[model samples]
Target: MRPYRSVLYIPAARERALEKAQTLPVDAIIFDLEDAVAADEKENARVLLARVLGEADYGGRARIVRVNGLDTPWGAEDIAAFRGAKIDALLIPKVGSAADVEAVARLIPDVPLWAMMETPAGMLNAAEIAAHPRLSGMVMGTNDLAKEIGARFRPDRLPMLTGLQLCLLAARAHRRIAIDGVYNAFKDDEGLRAECRQGRDMGFDGKTLIHPAQLAIANEEFAPSDAEVDLARRQIEAFDAARREGQGVAVVDGRIVENLHAATARQIIARAEAIAERAI
Candidate 1:
């Protein structure tokens, strides 16, 4: 799981979701606790999550748990309860600072952490948070971010671009994979696809998804298109041929090509290949 590009959603306390997890064509599955769970059912959700994690084998898919933030009543119990659970990574919610990250890291030293940047405070200290070695990546929580910042949501996301770019920079500075927030419209496939295109162009590894319908689009958008994969293959082949002929750079289809371009092409091909294997 080299930074999943199509992380899936498995509803908290939903046992059928756990069974679906085994067959879903997703790069990763986030067992959620924050938004999908109701207040009265929090304990029940945790217990079910524990059992699902303890017993289910998610094949090669990642199994991440989106635990409540420390400020919430259930947060501490969420952290402590993972003592014997087999979770791959802990998705800490509303992480405000590096110290907050350190606090969770201290409690669970063995598990990798993906901090959510959903508050103004979280965005301000993103650079510091990214510097943590135990930190695997960042997930933008748009709804919480909007609520915290008192900002209005635009369909074009113009108001949030600067903040999104800031988070992207922090992740890039620390060589971390940055994941975009969900589009929030499960019924609007066009809306979701547009957001997915934006996320991909903006350099996010993937977009955090909410519903099952979003999974295929996320996987398809983030992964290279067939044309891109073909071009990448052509670029690699040309580069190899040039290298064998004692050349530093190669020209394929009249376009200048270098090692950097070839490397990028390889990443594109790799994701496409993964999607292909999953399809089978």
Candidate 2:
């Protein structure tokens, strides 16, 4: 029940951003060595990231490193550099199949693996990728997916729904963490809020963010709200009371609280507790 309310990506090449990231109220930091870094600066970024990761103490925030695809010249070296480094997970880019995960897993057998679900093939084969024993999470790369699929920008994300749902379904079915794609317009706080709400409703564990400005909104939207926590507590209490009375169902605010509802309520309470622990 680790709360992944806001996951921010910081370019590995930018030392200042990397340093600033330690203080941000983000649940996880993806040390991006792929899309964010320029081609010429790849090696330098990888070396700098390895050094920073060794020295920096990011507290409870999960430290994940996004390595370039194995097809690229820097990708293999990128994986090799972080083999023994301290990291929560290794994110493999453009992972289309379980075999892709296996290749990286063979190189770094100990660390958990996360896959970037972006390409069309990746969406189609998401179930297999999510089912991989070493895989721990799935990240939606909407920018790449939209570009590859020729999708136009829409507020409701109508065009991207299929791919998003596909990866989400796979992640959920495999019991893996499912993080939604970034909202490109960092300055549009309202738009970011709307999308975050949408993702949270759709069962994504959290949203991946491109900029620090997007962190607060994401953290707010993904975490359990005060009202939600209150409702969860009431529901759990009602359900327990009913069970003690030899009843199978209970009522909470005009809604029935069945066993399934109680289960969900317990999870909500646990998540809220976990978030509180993170704050402390």
Candidate 3:
């Protein structure tokens, strides 16, 4: 139940941003060497990031590197450079199939792999991609998906629902971490909060963010509230008492608490505890 509440992307080429990220209250940092870096700086960014990762102590923050796609000229080299580097995961962009995961897995056997689910083919074959044994997470690439599918911007994201839901379903079915796409409006705090709430309600583990300004809202929206935590504790206690008396169900605030509900309650408590522990 590790927290994936606020995953921020920092360009690998920017030394100052990389140094500053070590202090940000983010659950994870995506050391981006793909979309964020210019073509000419790709090789230099990879080298610089590898050096920073070795020397920096980011505490409990998960350090994941987003590499260019294998189809790109710099992709294979990016994968090779991080082969022995200390990283939690290697994020492969435009991953359309399990074979795409295998291509990178063979090179970096030690670290876990995460996929950028963006293209139409990727959405349709999400099950196979999520089922890959080495894959640990799936990130929604909403901007790219919208561009590829010719979708217009809408507050509700009606046009992007199918692709978002498809990848989400696959990630859950395979028990992989599912993170929603970024909200491009970095300055729009209210808009970000609304989308974060929507993603949380849809069962995403967290949301990917493009800027540091988006971190606080994301961490708040994805984490369990005090009221929710209290209810979970009460539900568990009530369920335990009911089972002791040969009862199969317990009532909490007029809602039935069965084995399934108790199980969910336990998970909520565990997730909250994990987040607290990370803070420490």
Candidate 1 lDDT, 136-198, residue by residue in tens: 889998888888778887788887777788899999999987999988889899999999999
> Would you list the clashing residue pairs of candidate 1?
none
Off by over 4 Å in 2: none
| Model 3 lDDT per residue over 134-172, tens place | 999999999999999999999899999999999999999
Per-residue lDDT of model 2, residues 1-280, tens digit only: 8889899999999999999999999999999999999999999999999999999999999999999999999988999999988999999999989999999999998789999999999999999999999999999999999999999999999999999999999998999999999999999999999999999999999999999999899999999999999999999999999999999999999999999999999999999899989992
RMSD of 3: 0.8
Off by over 4 Å in 3: none
Roughly what TM-score does model 2 have, to 2 decimal places?
A: 0.99
User: Global lDDT of each model?
Assistant: 0.85, 0.95, 0.95
Q: Estimate each model's TM-score.
A: 0.93, 0.99, 0.98
RMSD of 2: 0.8
What is candidate 2's local distance difference test score? 0.95
Residue clash pairs of candidate 2: none
Q: Residue 162's C-alpha lDDT in candidate 2?
A: 92
